[model samples]
Target: MSTTDYLTQGRRVLEIERAALATLEKNLDAQFSQACELMHYCQGRVVVTGMGKSGHIGGKIAATLASTGTPAFFVHPGEASHGDLGMITKQDVVLALSNSGETGEVVSIIPVLKRLNVPLIAMTGRPDSTLATLADVHVCVAVEEEACPLGLAPTASTTATLAMGDALAVSLLHARGFTADDFALSHPGGSLGKRLLLRVADIMHTGARIPMVPTGAITTDALLEMSRKGLGMTSIVDDNNKLLGIFTDGDLRRILDLRTDVHQTPIDQVMTAGCITATADMLAAEALQLMESRKINSLIVVDAQQQVIGAFNMHDILQSGVI
Candidate 1:
């Protein structure tokens, strides 16, 4: 096909899928609410099962539900018949998916689910199908047409199914009062998890790790502390450890340009007074924003009494993998 034909075909597919999604939204009725209520009150995990393409979408839906505070996992319909069916208990809810609602492997397990007293939630394009009739709650994900030019591939139908699954997951998420911390608990290893859960206190240099110079110290003392701490900057504080100013490598370069004797000049003479500061309770991501917005490399952390308790630099956030 020509380039123009390819572009037209791609855009047409997207328009079909977008229209399908719009239809799904309009058709969302009480069934959607009932499905959410069932999953929300489920005493056990949501066991999602499907056949082929539906299976792929079901897996993603299960993962989303699991991460959003709903306990859920995907089980293959084929595997469920062999032994995974035993995984479902009376307390759990079974979410079955099939566009036509008549996949043999999925249909074969309906009776067993009934016997196990597990509630069944069916997502299907045809509400009159056998699976829909058998389900305790039927969520219609009907789409007008497939995005594929062949009209045979599961395109628009699958997109509608995924969108409906997301709606269900998010409803349950809000119903459970799920917080970012709760989400972070599920995604602790990812960069997104680090951004949401990491705090300044967790990654900031504290105690001996922090470099400090008293107000009366020479500029050379600040330079030594900066070199020893290797954070590119040092906090200048008072006798009570209240932050007074900061002397960075940038300050030294500027002072050197003026030909000031570092050994003779007091640290306060060259330090940037009333520098920006952060609290230990601040989020590392927020601190990163502050640093970026202010065009600074580091910040001094203070307590409620404004004493220098800790400090951090951009490198610390990078090393901690919060970015």
Candidate 2:
């Protein structure tokens, strides 16, 4: 085929799938709401099952549901018959996907599911098919046609099924009031979790590692502390460990321009008072935002009484993968 023909064919495929999704949107009725309600109230996991391409889509749906605060998992229908059916419990809800609703392996498990009294939610093109007829809730994922020119392959149907699954998951997610923090808890290893869930206390320097000096300490002494702590700045605190001010490398350069006697000048004389501070419980991502917004590289983490307890810099956030 010529390049133009190939491009035309690809566009046709996309257009067909787009139309299929549009049809799905119009067809959504009370049945979609009922499915969401069933999954929402399910005391146990949402067990997704299917065969072939539908199986792949079902697995993703199960994953999305699980990550979005819903407890869910995927079970292969073929394996369910080989003893995995024991995984299904009375408390769980079964989400069965079959465009035809008559895949032999999926259909064969209906009796067992029925015996276990697990609520069945079917996504299928045929509302009257055995799977749909037997399900407690039927989510019609019917597509006008396959994206394949020959109309043989599973294309548009699978897209529609996946979109329906997304719609169900998001609806249930909202109904449950699942927050970003809740999502981060489930995905602690993912970037979103690092940004939303990780706190300043989890990554900030503490104890002896925090660059700090007494308020009356000389500029030379504070610079020594900053060098030793390697944070580019030293927090000047009172005898009670309450933060008084901060002296940074930038301040040192400015003081040097004035030819200030570093050994004689008290660190507090050159320090920036009322500097921004963070709490240990504050999210590291929020700290990064503060740094970027204020054009500062470091922050002193304080207690409720404003005592310097921890410290962190831009490098800490980058190292912790919170950037």
Best by TM-score: 1
Per-residue lDDT over 1-323 for candidate 2, one digit per residue giving the tens place of the 0 to 100 score: 99999999999999999999999999999989999989999999999999999999999999999999889999999999999999999999999999999999999999988888889999999999999999998999999899987888999999999999999999999999999989999988978889999999999999899999997888999989998999999899998999999999899999999999998999989999999999999988889999999999999999999999999899999999987
Taking all chains together, the TM-score of candidate 2 against the true structure is: 0.95
| lDDT by residue for model 1 (42-71), tens | 999999999999999999999999999999
Residue runs of model 1 more than 4 Å from their true location after superposition = none
Shift of residue 193 alpha carbon in model 2, Å: 2.4
TM-score of each: 0.96, 0.95
lDDT of candidate 2 vs native? 0.94
